[model samples]
Target: YNIHPSEKLIQAFRKKPYQGCCPIQAEFLFIGLDANYAYDIEEQKIFPKVIEYHKDAISFWKKYNVHHPFLLDGYKGDGRKYHKEFSKIRLTCEDSSRISFIELLHLPTTGRNNLRNTDLDKNHLKYIHQAIVSQYTKAVFISDAVFRLMKKTSTFSWMQDAREIEGYSLKVFHETSPLIYKHLHFSTYGKFQAQKEKEMKAIHMIISKI
Candidate 1:
């Protein structure tokens, strides 16, 4: 399937508070906090250009049948740990092609702790909602932080049932339209190594139902 972002969605991404790439539409959406690469105000002036660059990259990969850079293994850099964890979840899925990702905050920082604030504008939340509704998103794996943020904003207020999975929570919006799973931030997996396997099992259980 050659899924593409709509022009309106692309505009939403362009006007995001921070610099980041637009997510591809897919069945599974992974929501995170923010990126690790920070750009100065001057550099951020070209955010529109950066968005176009990412759009072009997505088009090139789709045309060549190459894996999305976000799904590639052996990545090295600030977000390597998070990338590794995402790879594990991707592997757990029966069809990796159905997965894609987006960040609640487009701002890039070396660490969440370093960020002065996490306040987001309406556009950021709209971008995520659009990403979900635009595709046949069957499931969403959200980082604990992002999940909490959504809860505070009542973004998933319609979701009334949540099933606990080894400390994590899996919420089903309906019979199976979209299953929202909340787990610890992927970057902190190293600190909770003891529960890694259990979390993976929980993730597998969720995917099995998908």
Candidate 2:
């Protein structure tokens, strides 16, 4: 009698779009993603999918002529965050083009009721840590940015690996820099959200501040 539902309930789980729903970060925050789940990037239509497997994505990025490798981290893995629930994409406009990195896995944004107390079981906690370590290694190897803003509230301090070195500053170097007021737009099924306007305005403010 649908005991399957109850059995699945007792087992551990990861939140999905079918669950409560995902909340995007505030308008001003930058976004980035890791490499593994890049296919999701195309499916989501967050941007045009770079083709030819690896070469095209890199080439499309280099097209802007602002090439620099940086470490990109996905989750802290300190029990404070769930890796699979928070898919991410990094956004930074440079040289007249928007730069992005696609990441998969993250904590659910839904409130406490959605979380399971068993999420902290030692095995579960270890798996989360392992995921973090693996992701961190890739980012470190590439020297991308961790996007610091996505870190869990406090379980562990989210720090970029020392090997990553310096990254681009939030402030644009040129007042007229193509990136200065570059607009990033988001749409859901051909319709735009009012939040997109706010994001644009906030970006302008950030540009003006720089």
Model number with the top lDDT:
1
Runs of candidate 2 exceeding 4 Å displacement: 1-29, 32-49, 56-58, 61-98, 104-192, 204-210
Query: Which numbered prediction scores highest in TM-score against the true structure?
Result: 1
**Residue pairs that clash (backbone atoms under 3 angstroms), model 1:** none
lDDT of predicted model 2: 0.26
TM-score of each: 0.60, 0.25
lDDT of 2 by residue, 115-177 (tens): 223232344333433433432211110112232322332321443223211332222312321
Residue 114 lDDT in candidate 2: 24
Q: What is the C-alpha lDDT profile of model 1 across 13-72, one tens digit per residue?
A: 455432222444466677876655322312334334334435554453444333233334
Clashes of each: 0, 22
